[model samples]
Target: MLPVGAGAIGTQARTADSPVMRMLDELNHPATAAHILAERTMLHMLRGHCNSPIAGYADTTPDGRMSLFGMVFKRDGSAFVRSHAWGDPSDPATLGSRVAADLLHQGAMKLIDATRK
Candidate 1:
């Protein structure tokens, strides 16, 4: 584990050059990879086939208390969570504002992924 938190650092930002818009981008890790892992973990655990828990995380603050989970689930109702840890202790508003926005982006991706099938 990367301490209690190290995922979140720096304020969230937007760049016009962004080719794709995913809030998970608020952190540096690839959301797709993290999501896939979460899905696999969730499915395996739920189905009793999991080798181990697949917990991945990113910093939302730097050492904050709270994690943004990328728990992945499919249209079939199988899923897992990808988590982002907070960088520091923060108010719910700060956590919700920054984290939620990015998660919303991630949720949209999940929908699209479901639709692709």
Candidate 2:
């Protein structure tokens, strides 16, 4: 099997104003929300889909910073590119975008595109 890797599971909600959305937001934990936002932002930036050979995870540090890790792999696991970074929890999207840029710079798209064939 491929080496063990990080993963995330999340639920989605409508961004439009609604009672349910407000209630969910009120119930959400700040750190958990930050982590999810960062991970999803990275995946969106990479155009990753459910079947894609992509992985992303985000978590909070002890000092309240957010840490993000992302990876994209070849279909056969023969090659891959990964990026990791730390950023302010208040702007997790920026951190995600930064890591996505790093992976793209490392030629992650070539590996990702090969999987489509």
Candidate 3:
């Protein structure tokens, strides 16, 4: 899907390393975070400042392709959907980052949902 801020993504392009990747490195899934960091497009889309663990898992296709799903939260407790490609549908290795994103996004979503209700 086309990201909302196409120009917002490259704002960090000049950085020697990705901030998202650096943040993810501090988490349980460093590789997953790194993947997200690599995708500047996705990073630009995530403007939320909330930090919490999200619940998630990667779904693998019969052909070994993985799809990551999850949500992101903002400091005010608002959240938006986050998703990514996990590469080969059936590969477990490709599932690592996707799973991490799912977990993080879900947890953030719940927090945002709770405050709104």
Highest TM-score scorer: 2
Candidate 2 lDDT by residue in tens digits, 1-117: 222124433546887858778877676677777777787787777777656788877878899888888888988888889999999999988998999899889988888777677
TM-score for all models, in order of appearance: 0.28, 0.79, 0.29
Could you say which candidate leads in lDDT? 2
lDDT of each candidate versus the true structure: 0.38, 0.78, 0.42
| Worst ten in a row by lDDT for model 3 | 2-11
Candidate 1 lDDT by residue in tens digits, 1-117: 321122434334466646444553655554333333333332333232222222333323344354444333344546533434343333333433344345444553454245454
Clashes of 2: 0
lDDT-wise, the better of 2 and 3 is 2
Worst 10 residues of 2 by lDDT: 1-10
